[model samples]
Target chain A: MIDSQKPASAQDAEHHRTKMQKRKAVQDKEVASKTVEKGLLIVNTGAGKGKSTAAFGLALRMLGYGRRVVVIQFIKGAWHTGERKALERFEDLVEWHALGEGFTWETQDKARDIAACQGAWRVAQQALANPDVGLVILDELNIALRYDYLPMEQVLADIAARPESQHVAVTGRNAKEAMLEAADLVTEMTLVKHHFKAGVKAQEGIEF
Target chain B: MIDSQKPASAQDAEHHRTKMQKRKAVQDKEVASKTVEKGLLIVNTGAGKGKSTAAFGLALRMLGYGRRVVVIQFIKGAWHTGERKALERFEDLVEWHALGEGFTWETQDKARDIAACQGAWRVAQQALANPDVGLVILDELNIALRYDYLPMEQVLADIAARPESQHVAVTGRNAKEAMLEAADLVTEMTLVKHHFKAGVKAQEGIEF
Candidate 1:
């Protein structure tokens, strides 16, 4: 009954199975013990590129379940993004506000950036208060926090006071330590390598 | 013309407008110079949890633009993922094949696992051959490669031979050096914190 050409041994497989069964038991028990249910404060930050993209994907997942979602853009409001165009088709399910003037470096004015961030925060607070919105994505909010465009204490307090059942996602680079500490889930995107450094130009559909 | 309560300075606003105009010109030039259009090999790897989620998000982005996409799950076929159920609404736009039996440790049979991976690779190769498929997501492929379930050289060769304009996303932990070398863009996810370690269980509609 031995298959000589296979990549793994039968004995190895059986041993793995036993080990996994035990692991599964532990995993199942661990998973079961997590009974706490509440809205999550998710932070996607670091030098990697998918923080905002991942947040947008979560938004899309929410929309798939027919839940209403609101996205308040803090920095990437200048260009038309693929996510924005795609979500527009789900007009009935998504409320998108591309509120920022543009990237901070492009604007080069701290005062204006802070003002734009504050403007977005007002709208986000309203989204947080609305029970109809199941998910609120504070896109690139971390950039504003990094630049002190909005007071960290106020942002933290506002997020903490969000509706019990409403989930919130914050994305950007160099997220504040306070924000990270308060997050239920924190994913740091590390840049192993980027195509931009290799002289590869950004494609419209892919980059934006 | 300066309002004390305004978020933006009138002068600053004008300066930003001029700056954006110049920046747009430069951006347009950079974009124009990037005329080479071809399929991209994107890799998401590391200890972070959003690798597959990010890849799925990329798939959703393609679906948003009305392009057909394919997702072939390698190590998570046993459980019913929220994404699999959610993608069902886009019946015509998506082709999701959860081909794995389960995690390798659970099955414990290396021969069987290798055969399963080989079978799935054949299916994936067909998906790659299809010109209409805009994106192909090889979910958890690194796991199969890690365990030597499938031949890595064959996998890389197949990916390289894919249609010129199609996009391929491979997600998992500990991706091989060859895979990373071949990838056009790579994002390494670093796990800063996970609820599982905090005794948090997986929740329905959230983790699944």
Candidate 2:
């Protein structure tokens, strides 16, 4: 009788252990699922067209969902056709700031353009600091960094420190490797095909 | 000589007549600062408080720079918290989608919620065709529209026709809208805020 009882007890203990292991596995899975987060970063680059346009589309998607968003246009100051006319309607929901005094060649003043870039950076810092802002798009920012108008290290640091829930996008040619690495999503817009190279200048209401 | 003088005078008159008019008032002010176009609609409605928090802070500001944006919040989505967030980040780039959905008890039932709303006619139609879709935030859409599973005529039409540049957002008390909205940016979070309400609860990150 003692031997039989011992065997039965041992079997019960083993069953309990198996049950505990299964429970633990389920709990671990639940935690993992809960911790999963969704965030996005879009990069539009290369010698192509529609970089800013793509960024703008993403920005609108986020906004329509009631996500707070910020956009900083780099190396573009002249009243371009699109932003000035079409984008201003949402004056209450959008903010537009021009950073370039004009392209470097047009102005022939690197120092002035750099100063303007610094001012834009200050604004970007403020936007990044805000926790409520969901998406921040740096339009043509890569060009500014390539030109050395904005400090690349500082920009990278700021992006790294942004609120975890926030999404940041950088658009322009030659996006820095650091920026690409920091991004949750990176898309390079290659010049597979474009109409402008055919000498068809940008038309109003279309390119703008 | 007289005949030659007459012809020259006529030529001068034509030239002067064609010259552009100069104004005493330099109307250099951007007459139409930005183009007014249809925008996406984002709705955030649920038992959670982060719907608008995520919407205004993350999406609206992104649209402010160059993307056309519009926001319409049903109910009292216009509390000081949301207002403060918008003021600080967007700089007047967002519009209030106000309808005073009122308290649940005051106007309860599917028929009433559906009746109160004119459908997503105007906003949805615009978002579908507009190309500069930066962001659209529809704060608290689920509770209002889901009371009856409201006919998705306007909503579906807009989504179907939405330009590549447009995106839509919807948030509210129940996830029924999520199913209906077919969101490109969807987030459903389990609640963690439990302190201040303590049974009769309403707190900052959890209730606002």
Candidate 3:
């Protein structure tokens, strides 16, 4: 009765179960094989939104684990953002810094721009050196490197010299090839479509 | 003397300032032209990480404004995650639900998977229908839709029927073309490089 009276759905279900059991075993083996652990340099770059936002998400996660999280914005000015307000609630574990005046065009002063980048980099270097800080986010550091405001070679060296167990997340568009090579993980946020193109203004609590 | 005695760097700086001033004028005008404001149908999809992480980031932003943010995970099981722990801190403004047992392969049971999707959809429907839910995140709903666990037409209809000012963020890979067409913003997280490829295990407070 169990075999002869089985419905089509039951047969299909049994087939699926068998296939899945085999797949799960292979996946479990593969997962178990991965045993290395070290600090990771994560890069979030591309033309789409959420590079910094995703970094902030990682900050939240790191903070959740009762670790120190430092965010240093390189190109974005000290704008009022919802993430800032929310993250500041975890004041004990969060160190927030908005070091730039805005984008390069917004700042316009080449000397001042370079000076700001240098200042931000100093702060970033300190965070990177700190073994106690679980995650250090150099927000929009790529733009500074792209504009030659900071030496890419020195930045990469500083990242390499960071604490072995401290993760760093760098977010921006046009991440330097050298930076990408140095990164353990890189995610390019591709812009499939944008609401700003559709004349949707950046709203509070959403765009920020 | 003002022009002839000027240093090369100063002259270059002046040129850059003039160029930037003109550019800023155009940008300001364009920004001012965007007057329309409404809820955004945002989609985060692709073959990379952070699709769900970015959604949680948005949830955090929404919660900053004392607004309600509901996250309904459709494909992910009730796994212990750092984002869940941190977001739960804002108990009054957040509603978290992890309805699926795991991925399709992990579950294997077609009937059970479909039932889980339906249950998740019901929860999502309630949040989407409510105007007070500033942002409703349909996490991994694309995977459920990709597998035909839920009717795409009905899902889209419910999203469209939501209140005018209720924002919705749908996250997963391989989002439907129809959904893309209906979305105000769509970001595809492209995997350039992944740490997992290097046999780096998913560490707590990082991958989770």
**How well is each residue in B38-140 modelled by candidate 1, as lDDT tens digits?**
6789999998778887887777677767888899988878653666766776789889888888877566666777888888999899999989999999999
Candidate 2: C-alpha lDDT = 0.54
* Tens digits of lDDT, candidate 1, A3-60: 5666565557766677778887886676688777777888899988789888877776
**Worst 10-residue stretch by lDDT in candidate 1 chain B?**
B199-208
Clash statistics: count for each candidate? 1, 78, 0
lDDT of 3 by residue, B86-190 (tens): 876788988989998887778878899999999999999999999888999999999999989999999999999999888999999999998899899999999
> Ranking under DockQ, best-scoring first?
3, 1, 2
Q: Predicted candidate 2: interface RMSD? A: 16.8
DockQ of 2: 0.03
Fnat value of model 1:
0.46
Give the alpha carbon lDDT tens digit for every residue of A3-46 in model 2: 45567756654554555466657755643544334344445555
Write model 2 residue lDDT over B47-118, tens digit each, in one string: 423455545434433543445555655544334353444333344544445544554333433344454454
Fnat scores for every prediction: 0.46, 0.00, 0.68
> Which ranges of candidate 3 are over 4 A from the true structure?
A1-5, B1-5
- Candidate 2 C-alpha error for residue A3, in Å: 61
Would you list the rank order by TM-score, best first? Answer: 3, 1, 2
